[model samples]
Target: MASRCIVLLVAVLLSSLLVVSSSASSSPCTFPAIFNFGDSNSDTGGMAAAFATVSEPNGETFFGEPAGRYCDGRLVIDFIAQTVGLPFLSAYLDSVGTNFSHGANFATAGSTIRRQNTTFFQTGYSPFSLDAQSWQFAQFKSRSQLAYKKGVSYKDQLPPEEYFSQALYTFDIGQNDLTSGYVSNMTTEEVKQTIPDILNKFTDVIKSVYGLGGRYFWIHNTGPFGCLPYVLDRYPLRAPEVDSVGCGAPFNEVAQLFNAELNETVAQLREAFPRAVFTYVDVYTVKYSLISHAEKNGKTHQC
Candidate 1:
């Protein structure tokens, strides 16, 4: 009789827990759109479009054709959408393929969180730069308007809110700001002074995306510069460290400071925008792991 009572009690507790879990699973931020804003790492095509260069050799391995992305193909933003049952984001230049009813990508090849990167990347524009992906995002609304006028709407039937809810906004920039601008030229002390300013600007960008009805937001820290080809070429002496997965102290030190500031900034943003769902993907960690495990994946370290 005592055993029966215990089993009955356990069953009741399980039932109660199920109710709680179900209620918590329903988040208001579960929307339908996904906006991606970042550099080559997350850019699906912003760079390719700007450079007028389609898929590169490395990119051909994954995405096939040239979708303007910088990776082997598909990036974090692509998987994020797929995780939520959304289709791959359409490229900014892909007029016929774009489906803004959900979300769009605004990541250029050399984009950064700072205006300096914005003004420095594009050879023709120099200041016209690859980092102005966010500016392209501003054009989405107008582009949508014209899409309808041109009779090329992807989802003319759905309500805006329903469409927006399905969206996810992401910003994966700053790599160039750190990698291109400061990493090569400036000393540690000079870079330290600018870290706070960099963090603050990134925080503001996250909030801006949220204000645009972007409930789902993600911020990327930075990709490893030590692993890039340029770094390998510049510091051949550090090849030993690279092979050991022990990054050169100087480059790694800069990365650490940047990541620390990034973490603190992310924490502050979370508190400021309690209603917004913010996630930070640690690209540094990913890069490090990929470097350490390159051989396991049957690949050799390039940079």
Candidate 2:
């Protein structure tokens, strides 16, 4: 899994450059910035700002201080940024003394793609829904324009074409949306029926960003929820529900269904936006591989 991760990061870096270089001739292929949206999978700080409980041990492994990231070390986004020679992105909610020149993270730990009123379940309300995250990005754009107009420092300005248009826009969401529904006692069929609406909302968010001059997108499908420690602990699988490797069959089947729809949606987006670069990353497969070969990957436990 470590080797696979390294290869994946390298591919991300190269593919980003390929997309940029293919679009323009005079400019270099390096990504000037990266704007990411999602939940805890790639959240850098939005969770910390929204909740006080996410502190200390959360970031102690690498940062030595609470950095708002859900992982002990760096996430896939961090690796992508480093591979592309960009600085680690800051969460938009952590605006104090943070830099947005390299872009910002709009993900929160418990954020969902569906807005509060639109969600299928009565889940906890969070202000960082996909709709709200798009609004925050709009605000960031407005502030950048205001700074440029006021002749503020160069670092404060967000050049439309040079930055937002050329930067890599990434999304890694929808896990919580399905999980929340399942935990709320919604049947699998009920959850499956909501997928089109969920993808519709997700499409709207992508179009909104595209309207804001985004031309490159890296969308990550949801991972295997059945293999998650929390899910495994909470939902004890029956003999038929468990796979040969011990992962929950029903949960993973739901995940694969979602990924299939997501893939089809990406294909449609490619057709809709012919000039744009849309890469659908199979995060589920990679994560599932880690779970299947845990000892080889040095992953002794699930988390």
Candidate 3:
């Protein structure tokens, strides 16, 4: 399974650069650190630190203990870190025994691109939206620099000043933004209407990071949430609304639409910031293909 994951990730990692460069290069480049922003798909436990720790079964399968991630083992972000020769990112919200020298994760379990009006307690939507995570990154950069300058002792745990500009900034959010709209009893059209504002806010946050010296960006488009039982149960579909593999068609349509808009947004971002390197990963294509293939059998898969 680990090997399979590595192959998949490496494929995506290589594919990500295809847009920026004419061809993918085999040569290696090292990033001193990684700054991640996303939801559960890449969260290293911001939600647990802010609210409650995820217990047992969450990490027992592969990690041998609760490692603060939402999954049984490491997340996609973890694999990316290992692939890049960096340590796993500590959750920015997790203060206990965390090391920021390598990088920090600002992703929460229920995070969205746009802030939801309802509380997490009410709808399980995170208050730490994409905009909020960007703010946290800004604060962390300034504060960690100050801490690093204090002494050599503090330098071991904090990142250096130069690492800020050289580090890879990764994003794996927007899935929850679409799901949040659905969970709020929104119609499909209503959810589609929110994409423009959401992408605009996403662009704004990217600009914020760019202003702070972040130059390299790796962004993952939202996955296929329509195949999940959680979404299927809530949004009871009509007979015609079910796809060939029995996934919610309307929900998947909305997700695809979101990915398309996000792609355009990335194009615009590249134009706006000519100096920055942007890698827009097509996670939706990979995830949807996997889920559809799995559903052809009697099984279901979740990202």
Candidate 4:
């Protein structure tokens, strides 16, 4: 199930890049770099740096050692970097051997789109929420500018305009937000009401990136949370509440509702930034389809 989801996301991102490259007559490194923001789904090594629990089997399938990725192998973002002729992105939180040349991963596990004053599920405040990530990005931009002004070469320093203006900004978030709400016992309608605030923070991130000269944006909406192994095991539904595919219908509906609003938000962003390109990938549909035909996709696990 994990492999299926990761592969689908990689395919969608690569396909989108291909289409853009073809139309613009650009190569794999069409953009100067890629700046990614998200949670565990796209985190490369943030969790490992911040926590000691991530080790061993977490990255053994591919790296043969712990590399901080939640999965046993490379993430979709790693594949996207490979497809674009760039090296794997180094997590910003990683202090050693950190390379910010091709861009950096600002995603952290358990990150939320909003900062919380109260604890959720015994989890304290996240230091790398969407807001905090944006601030880190802004700091990166500042340092890059300062480095450029000090006569540093491109290889040794990050060029502000070349890296920021031409970079592909990608986001894959909001799953944790919904998860927190559900676990906190919020009703479906209450969770739905939180969508606007979540999206507003997303919008702020986009606008902040735009101000930093970002013009290409790839936004991924939340996937089928109801079908995840964790959710399936924790919240078993009655017969009527389960879908034909054995997923919890109510939970899936909440995800769909969030995706719907996210799509609309992307459309509005395109209008607001006429010169920028915004692509909203329908991740939920792609993931759900793979789950529906698990045998055909070589997925044996129910999740």
Which number leads on TM-score?
A: 3
TM-score versus the correct structure, for each prediction: 0.75, 0.87, 0.90, 0.90
lDDT of candidate 1 over 159-244, digit per residue (tens):
25445444656666665666554434676567666778777777666665556556656666665665555555555544455546
Please write out the lDDT profile of model 2 over residues 161-223, one tens digit for every residue: 368888888898888778767766777888888889999999999999998888989898888
- Where is the poorest 10-residue window by lDDT in model 4? 1-10
Model 3: colliding residue pairs = none
Better of 1 and 2 by lDDT: 2
> Taking the tens digit of each residue's C-alpha lDDT, what string does model 3 give over 42-79?
77879999997888777766679888776666677877
Query: Which candidate has the top score in lDDT?
Result: 3
**All candidates: CA RMSD (Å):** 11.5, 4.4, 3.9, 3.1
How much lDDT does candidate 2 score? 0.75
Model 4 C-alpha lDDT per residue in residues 193-279, reported as the tens digit of each score:
899999999899899989888888888888888887777786777899888998888888999999999999999999999999887
CA-lDDT, candidates in order = 0.56, 0.75, 0.80, 0.77
State the TM-score for model 4.
0.90
| Cα lDDT over the full model 4 | 0.77
Question: lDDT at 29 for candidate 4?
Answer: 45
